[model samples]
Target: MSSNNTSQIAAASALGRLSPVANAPSLESIVAAATQLVPLLREQGQQTEINRRLSEEMSRRFEEAGFYRLMQPARYGGYEYGFTAMMDLISEIGRGCASSAWAAALGVIHNWLLALFPEQAQDDVWGPTPNALMCGSYAPVTMAEPTEGGWLIQGKWKFASNVDNSQWAVLGVQFPPAEKGAPPGAGFVVVPRREWTIEDDWFVAGQAGTGSKTVVIGKPSFVPAHRRLLFPEAASGKAPGTAVNTNPVYTIPFLAAMPVCLASPLLGAAQGAIDVFVDMCGSRVTRGGAGGGGNRLSGFSHVQSRLAGAAAAVDAARLVLDRDTSEVEHTVSAGNAISVDKRIRNRRGHAYSAKLCHGAIQDLFTTVGASGLTLDQPIQRIWRDGNMIAQHITLNWDAVSTMAGQQMLGLEPKGAY
Candidate 1:
């Protein structure tokens, strides 16, 4: 065996001494738990961005609060909550710190993603540490070499959110065809931290605390066959891991509502901006105009309209998110396959919801004028983070809107659904 293989084996053996599994917490209690941390999250928000990573203390708090277990498999000590519940919890966190919430949201959703892998892959991750978190880069940018038992993979994966806090990584790789007539295939392979190294390249103006750096395997690493999960298997709503996991939550098609994980944080960040703007309106005074320096900014009808519009936008976005998420969960619970139409509709909802949230933040930011631009102010950060999130390909308005329009018009949707 190679040194890499030996290291993996020894690490796996050490981690195989599993910790005692705790019972899952109720959704209400977990949401309350997350709410209780908002004050602290805000307190640390600046430092989190300065460090370009979530504080270790905050990560520990999230772990203790069972935030990571919200959508995890019950057999592995997770709460097994659905997407709607996840939205509630993550949005609450985002209200305090968008970047931290982004990291936490990914941590929460990846538990659900990992459950879609094969049984041994799940076991390889959770058997040793049931509460272990995973970070992922889902673009298949590299190919893997076929070898004994599995494949040898080596590449750098970017935008691995919350990578600093994760014990494992789910990397997207393209597998070469097994035969001359076969075509190439794409899939994910789970690897332990021992097999890869982190690159400190996550500096950004928005969501900086997420630590979404690059994960590199400078040398080829062997991944066992059972650790792989193909894209089609995941999108089919009947993944291999579903056989053992058996939860309808796991059976929901990938891309149907997975983008909600990206949207929820923006929902909260927009709300947070509104919160700050509302407070500022009450105390801020107008200056250098006919209104003079003593005039209350909140007295202006235009300011009132901005607040109302922002509030309405947030409310509308939430309704769309709640409706689509409920429909997905209900359909899966009834053992019905999530239809392509519904999937595309959900995709539209995700992208549109993000747009609404981004617009709300932009409206509130305009009302705040110069005060909202300060680095110390949370509104500026929220505004910046919301803009960054809106730029994500999955949530981009132009791309998703066109794709949704095509699907609605009885044409083939040309984008990932």
Candidate 2:
């Protein structure tokens, strides 16, 4: 049987509401589920790469464990746990396999974004299947024309991670042209899986299993107003569903808040690299036995220092994510909107954290020597994953640092920063 079919069967077999009633799974239970899945994810890491996406089994297991529902609304049977808990989950999963972690993180975060849409949109997705997965691309590429029902949308959205695993998609589009004085508007439109086609074009050297393919809308389709959420409304935390889904976690800004999910996995990947490197060090011996004796590679001060630095870098990355997420949470809990400065700081922190992850992977990879370059070596995969993550637009150091610098100078920060 095809992998997709097998995965569907697996997920269906394991399918049951994590929270059939109001009470959701305990944090400990949810975390344990993620922790336990690590070995399986690691075992499937190679297959995930070969398949160019996550396995059906892993996705189903995440559903059974309620990992995808961490930030979902309780009213819809989601756990609604805070972002910190989800980050912790993602980091733990990342240590096992970065690709799986990436797919899991993106697939889960899309649900949180859906929470910000109108109640009708939320119901349309979760009403039938609360366990239904959502995936998306933030780039506004669709063209919209004003129509009787709402707007007719057409175009393609790229880099939709884990698109195959999802039942719905939240796509970006430019609204129909506005009046002369009014600025052109951009927004997100909720479309069911049947409304769009997945372009199986996700080919990359790293994070290949994310299945971040292009989603195409061939003919125009009507999207009602209830399914549309403008960028401005989302960024200001004044979403349509705010009245119903009143959790403080939903109050976080969309642009500034979501990047944390992206960076979380990289930290885990770097840590995973460190773990494998340390293991390799313990067993690997240098040529000539390092002074004609049975000297372990780890016995060298050089290897020890590199390992120590990598660990410290990974630790620092975790701290940055924790601090930034906590501050955002505090702001929301205090009934205050996240300020522009604070949002800028989040961008800085996310980018810096990614930088630290990249450095950590590089530190360990460089010292591991030729064997580390082999395809079967786990650290090689980790190193590639880390490098690719650093390339993500949200985590690009130069661009984010520039934005932070602009904010510091009393000039308005540019772009998403």
Candidate 3:
């Protein structure tokens, strides 16, 4: 139900195989397009905030750039660019608008999860439309029981991101418990959009544009066994997706790459925050400390220090995110298991990056002053978005240090975050 890692399933057969995804085409083009479209997105961002959702134009631009297919497997007409490509693009999108990037990222990643469905389950959704979208809240459980050919799922799942735009959903359910100490049965059920209704439940703080609503599945619906994938199986190395998706990337653990996916956007948002703050420093006036400082705010020594600190934070964050992304691509291509120690290291690196974003935006926003609170001010939005991002499970600093400590001591972290 959480985010995931990139490909890495080693065996005698995988030793000789390379990454199935194309490599020559760097992510530069997509990132460039996202950067170029920022001003355009800003024009609509204000409206999206007012409307409490991402603007249609913003969605279309991302879709046209194939953002929606970033994670879906290749056999289903998806780019399957792996975590690197997705991280790069998401970072770029984040530069323009955090909420927009978060929504798109969720939609795309969830699609990849859907691609892991058993062939029969995959067919029901993608067979009708390869690009069919599925979203979920991933919080509550949807109960299911064995039936003739499948399990009947019944329960409500809340916080289904982008539900209004999806045609189907993947609901995590706790199946009937098995023997006491034996593994508990769990699965993700695929259900049609019409079979469930959306409730306007996302009325909280930041990332408001994500439209994270509640999914109401009143009664049990027959979910062909093929349409259900065991959650515990996925937690382990084995997954039904392997039968249909032969690529090693599909076999990669979901929680592993999740850090990369989420961290990249935070880095981007931080970079964007730095850019705005530096630009603001050049024109703004300081308080009564120095009367009529020459050439505006640029003359102050403290101003220089703040700029340096904020800029350094942004740079550090980008490096950590980029390094983790490369680590994913390289390790996956080589077909190696990312040891728990390595995962812990990555968690620490990524959490530090999140800290950079959180600190930089807050630090820089302070200098911008009272004017920065306006709705039109980019700083205000960046502050809100960055704070929201810091709360993501992947970036929780406490959890990162705890897991890292466990790893160093050779104890199972249990993926606590």
Candidate 4:
């Protein structure tokens, strides 16, 4: 049998032994399912990059593993495990393939994002197909025209990740000002697949497997009022969907903890780099160096130090992610609003963790010598993916640090938290 079929059969056997409910697997069992896919993911990493998108079998595998439902409402056949659980699961997937993990991370987190929309929007998505997934573009680059019952949107939304697998899209657009002379407000409008077309425009040097193409609305599409969610409302603990979903997980601010999904995959990619580095070190020998031709790479002090530093950095990043995410979950569950200070701190944690992970991968990549430059080397791919992730607007170290520092110094923070 093919590896894909064999993997499916094995996953089925494991599920039969572990989870009684296929839709709502226990955290341990679900994580175990992700763990089992790691080898397959690693095996497919090259092909995934080559295709510039995740395979149908891979998407199906993730769905069967129940990874996408980690943060969805239980009423919608999800586990509602919250952000930390998502971080843990995505990080494990990252250890195998960062691009796949990136796509999967967004797939899972968008479920939580959808839960923050109005009840009608939620039902529109999951009421008919509970397993349906969504892709999103978060920059409000165009303004929506006020229509009779809702709004008419026409434009292209870039970087809609995992667009190939998604049945719906949450597009960012500016709504007309509530009052004359007021500035237009930014928010999201949920549109079904029929309303938009996917543009094949995601060619990039890193994270190519995410399939983050452009979503184009060639003609004006009418989105009902109930399908819209304003940014401010999402940033607040109480969103329109909160009344019905009522999960503390949905109450957490959008930018406060959502960036963790972006950082979690980098954390896993850094660890994966370390794993490949160590394995390479164990067998590699110097060919032509001042020291000697046959000396073992691992016996060198520089190699050992790089490994230690990289491991420490990865550990520190994981700690920051866990602490901040856990704190958010605890505060929201206790009925407390996520304070501004906490939000900025969490933002700092997200950026700093990405910095740490990128640094770790960079340190490891430098030690790999000329062989690491080859396309087949996983370390090179990890390094590129890490760099790409760190450069994301949400995780960019300089921007995030400046925002946090401004908040700390009693100046109004300038950017999204």
Best by TM-score: 4
lDDT by residue (1-417, candidate 4, tens digit) is 899976754443232123223556677888789889887888788889989888889999999888997888888888788787888899999999999999999999999999999999999999999999899999998999998999999999999989999999999999989999999999998999999999998889999999999999999999999999999999998999999988777899998899999999999999999989998989888897685899888998998999999999999999888878877876776788989899999999999999999999999999989878988888899999899999999999999999999998999999897
- Relative to the true structure, candidate 2 reaches a TM of 0.92
Candidate 1's TM-score reads 0.93
After superposition of all CA atoms, the RMSD between model 2 and the true structure is: 8.8
RMSD in order of candidates: 10.2, 8.8, 5.5, 7.7
lDDT of 1 at 57: 82
lDDT of each: 0.88, 0.84, 0.71, 0.89
TM-score of each: 0.93, 0.92, 0.87, 0.94
Q: List the candidate 3 regions with Cα displacement exceeding 4 Å.
A: 1-26, 180-183, 286-295, 414-417
Q: Give lDDT tens digits, candidate 3, residues 207-276.
A: 6777777888788777777777776555443578778777666666666666666677677777777777
Per-prediction backbone clash count: 0, 0, 9, 0
Distance (Å) between predicted and true CA of 123, model 4? 1.0
lDDT of 2 by residue, 337-384 (tens): 888888999999999999999999999999988888877788888888
Q: What does candidate 1 score in Cα RMSD to the true structure?
A: 10.2
Model 3, position 89: C-alpha lDDT score: 79
- Model 4 / residue 94 / CA error / Å: 0.3
Show the lowest summed lDDT stretch of 10 residues, model 1. Answer: 12-21
Runs in model 1 with CA error above 4 Å?
A: 1-23, 179-181
Off by over 4 Å in 4: 1-23
